[model samples]
Target: MRRGGAATRPSLARDTGLSKPTVGQALLDLEQDGLVRPAGRTSSGPGRTAVLYEADPAAGHVLGIDIGRGRLRLAVADLAGTVVAKVDEPNRCRSASALVRTVHDLATGVVAQAGMTLSDVVKTVVGSPGVPDRGGRMLHLAPNLPGWGRRGLLDELEAVLGPGLLVENDANLAAVGERDQGAARGVDVFVCVNVGTGIGMGIVVDGQLFRGAHGAAGEVGYLPYGWTDTDSEGWTPSTPGILEQAAAANSVVKLAKEHGVRNASSAREVFQLARQGDACARAVVEQEATKLAFLVASVSAVIDPELVLLVGGIGSNTDLLIDPLEKAVREISPLSPRIAPGELGEDAVLTGAIATALRAAQDIVFDRRGENLVTQRSGVNA
Candidate 1:
């Protein structure tokens, strides 16, 4: 079933090196259980056209949700991994309770748009900004979203979304999304650097997602830049990390202010001004590019990945920063990892969440083919 496309019984037998009778019997069982359905017949060949079998679209459903500082996105997909509906909205909720209600409403609406209900969803994966602690009780390193790091938050989410819900770091999901379908496809070792309102990284090594011992492997925003531990007497513990404070959206606006660019509220506005030949804005962008280049050098010096994918709202603006970033990195480091804009854009996290949910749903569905039968059946690698 990992083929992800329809295949005939004969093809399945050939691919798995199983007998035709075994493949036929497995397909029959899956069909009877409503987990597999007949697709159209194959093109005419030597003798007769063979019917193709595919995972049943109606047998199971999954939901993917991306909860970000500025927006909330949701997508509904079926057992076959086809996305049927998607929705995005500005995130105005200030409190955790409001965020939970919003998530439920958005998920319900998207599922309804796909002609299904929330109860029909077999698994749900949420991509967010922080890593859950060892006990899965609280989320840490998510200062942008107020009231999100409190204890018992995961329990509250599970209570509302059911036991099949999972929470993952948004950047990690973005890397998975890219690896599965976007710029990082087939690249074994790469880094996805997401620069938006905040900064983070998603590391993939040896064709697998590498979450460090504490599930905080990619939290590069904490890298010390302008700030140091000896000068931390007046710094707030919850303040934005050093590198993030120096390079993210707030820093852009701060740099703009220092250079006398008036009335620009957002980084997007700053970039626009830079494009219009504003010298101050241009300087700010140069500084941002230089900081990002230093970040890339740091990463390249450590892991030496094959590629680096720049994602998120500010990072994806390839027209403005790509050239400068490349030049800066080349100047500072001997290692040269190809840096490219994320192809999936805003949908990367949602796509990744859906992909993860689909895999989990498939595992559950296939495991239900009777425990003994799944294990004893010849060449049935379920």
Candidate 2:
């Protein structure tokens, strides 16, 4: 009853492809283990009235974390996907070591607020920037946070978070979040483009994340824009590409200042002034949109995703960016996909992390209840 709760034995048997007797025995074992409990009887079904069962909230817990350069978000949920507690705080730590410690402390604190401890968290998912290596250890090209791309990043996190830990790319989690409950609900193929202090893309194809061969599928910031052969010669695996430097939030402020948009220190102010009809600020925003359009065009030409979700601090301003951005994409290439704003706002990564954690937690909780030794199953089924 992890998904569709409170089903009859026949319904459960049909859904799981098990015999009615097997489903009955499995339910008994799960009830014995306290993983599931009767939730009253069904009253209005076609067949005779039947008893119903649901997942017990006491089965286990899940913890999800979103670590960004600016803020750290944490949430704890139960077996039913209900959020128990949450914590959102600005990230003041400058070094990776400090950040790791802060995450550990915050995780513990939130779990405690949820009336639990670390041991109760059956699964923990962390959403972070950068591409994780094949070993799921070191993060690559994570320049926004100081000293994060170094090796042993996951080792440190695992040490604190304990087992059943998953560290995923933040942008990937955003796309997952959008798919689970946000804009991409039924979208089979799409990309979530995150634009903030840095830029990244997360591809969802056929209802799943498409991490390229080496787990670096959606590193769009590394895409070449203004790089020359000389620039390529100096580039390394850890170095971010010209696209991020020229198209990200910092570039917005720089372009705004160059265009004589006075007192613009951040991209937010530029967008605000543009909304207020400041000609120079609007010009800066238009340039930014064109850059984003070219980036979108390049991506659309390759994968041809059905939708492009613009997210993050600068990207969520779809009202101002969409018209110009789409027009520029049409001008740049014929392969233009429908572009839209992300529905989850700034918390997309955290929402994704929670959903992923809940999925894993629910799976483990139910699958363990169904698992039986061959001998046990033979006797029980008989």
Best candidate according to lDDT: 2
Model 1, C-alpha of 352: deviation from truth (Å): 1.4
Worst 10-residue stretch by lDDT in candidate 2? 369-378
User: Model 1 over residues 133-228: C-alpha lDDT tens digits?
Assistant: 749587899988889998988888877777868999999999999998899999999999999989989999999989999999999888887666
The TM-score of predicted model 2 comes to 0.90
* Local accuracy of candidate 2 as per-residue lDDT tens digits, 211-245: 99988898889878867777678676666677887
- Model 2 residue 125 CA deviation (Å) reads 1.0
Poorly placed runs, candidate 1 (over 4 Å): 1-5, 9-29, 42-49, 134-136, 228-231, 370-382
* TM-score per candidate: 0.90, 0.90
Please estimate how well model 2 matches the true structure, expressed as its whole-model Cα lDDT: 0.88
Q: At residue 274, what lDDT does model 1 achieve?
A: 88
Supply candidate 1's per-residue lDDT for 21.
85
